[model samples]
Structures are given as structure tokens and as C-alpha cells.
Target: MTVRNRDFYKGIIKKMLTERLTKYEEDGYKYSLQYNSCTNSYCLYYTCPGEKHWDGCAAVEASEV
Candidate 1:
């Protein structure tokens, strides 16, 4: 989805920080968010909790405005 509103993303970041939700589990998978200092952005990571390896893992980076 495309979001033009910067406040929307900021709100999500704020909520995540307020809740201390750097990592969480949902639908049997673990999701995490990490900030990249060099890029000045956040990346959403997902991986299967049952997996022994890093297979099927991926990250989605939020574009900076």
C-alpha cells in the first residue's frame, strides 16, 4: 500500500516505541522492526519461528520521505 501521509508512519513508529514492540509474534511467525542508522529508516523483518534456518525470511524497508 502507498501512504503519502508522513504522520501516519510516524504514528506507527510512535506506537511501536510506546508499546516496546520491537519484536512480536503473530500467525506463527515472528515479526521485528529495526532502524537503520545509515539509511535513516526502518525495516520490517519476518521469519518463521519453527524454522531452524533463515529460509523464507525477508525484510521490507519503509521509504523515507
Candidate 2:
């Protein structure tokens, strides 16, 4: 899928996101779907609330080709 527009990525991530895969919630956000430029993929990441870093766990990713 050639996802060039913002809406397409948003829909994919929102649909594929599974709450069971996320953890950590101390203050703010708990889940995120980040775009990896090197791999050209989207990865689901979890972090402690208010923090913007990965929680040291392997992420679930989907490549775009």
C-alpha cells in the first residue's frame, strides 16, 4: 500500500490497534503508532504516560511497500 496521505495512515493504525498490546499509563498517552522512515513501516509502541519513549518492548510493525 502506498500510503502518502495522512488520513490513510490514520485509518490503518486506528483499525489495527489492539489495546491488549499496550502497557504503561502514569499520566498521559499510553499508545502510539509511529512511522519508521528507515524501514518504511508503522510500529505500535507503548510508553509510560507523559513520556515519549518506547517501553523497551518489541513493537508490532506493518511494512508499506
Candidate 3:
């Protein structure tokens, strides 16, 4: 995707995580951002409460992470 799109997504994720959310919930997704990211990937990751693996990452590539 274009940089503008990437930035837009990043901003949204940042807002969701920082403001919209109050606390972590089971199966409920949160947002995350990586600055100066080396991955060069817009793919997001997550951990569900009590989960050992991030196999259930909250990735959205909807133009979703």
C-alpha cells in the first residue's frame, strides 16, 4: 500500500490503543504501532489474555493491518 494509507492505518491503530480502549478483554483486539519499524510490514500483532502464543494476533489488512 501507499505510504499515506500506511500512515492512516497507523494513526487509527494508535488512537484505538491509546484512547478508545479502556482495558484488555478476552478475544477483544487492541491496537499497536511501530515507529521506525524495521519490519517494513503493516502487519499488526497481538496477545489474548492468558494466551502463550500470539497465534491469535489482531492483524487487520482491511485496507486491514
Which candidate comes out best when scored by TM-score?
1
Give the distance in Å from residue 27's predicted Cα in candidate 3 to where it truly belongs: 9.5
TM-score of 2: 0.32
Off by over 4 Å in 1: 1-18, 55-65
lDDT per residue for candidate 2 within 1-65, as digits (tens), equals 11135554344365555443323342354545565777666665555545567663333345431
lDDT values, one for every candidate = 0.55, 0.47, 0.43
If both were scored by lDDT, which would come out higher, candidate 1 or candidate 2? Answer: 1
Which scores greater on TM-score, model 2 or model 3?
Answer: 2
For model 2, where is the 10-residue window of minimal lDDT? Answer: 18-27
Against the true structure, candidate 3 reaches a TM-score of 0.30
Candidate 3 residue-wise lDDT at 48: 43
lDDT of 1 by residue, 2-65 (tens): 2225464454555566788987665566556688778767765555657644333233344532
For residues 1-65, could you state the per-residue lDDT of candidate 3 as single tens digits? 11224564455565655665533333343434333345434444444445555533233443433
Number of backbone-clashing residue pairs for each candidate, in the order shown:
0, 0, 4
In candidate 1, the residue pairs with backbone N, CA or C atoms under 3 Å apart (3 or more residues apart, or in different chains) clash, namely none
Can you give the TM-score per candidate against the true fold? 0.49, 0.32, 0.30
Top candidate by lDDT: 1
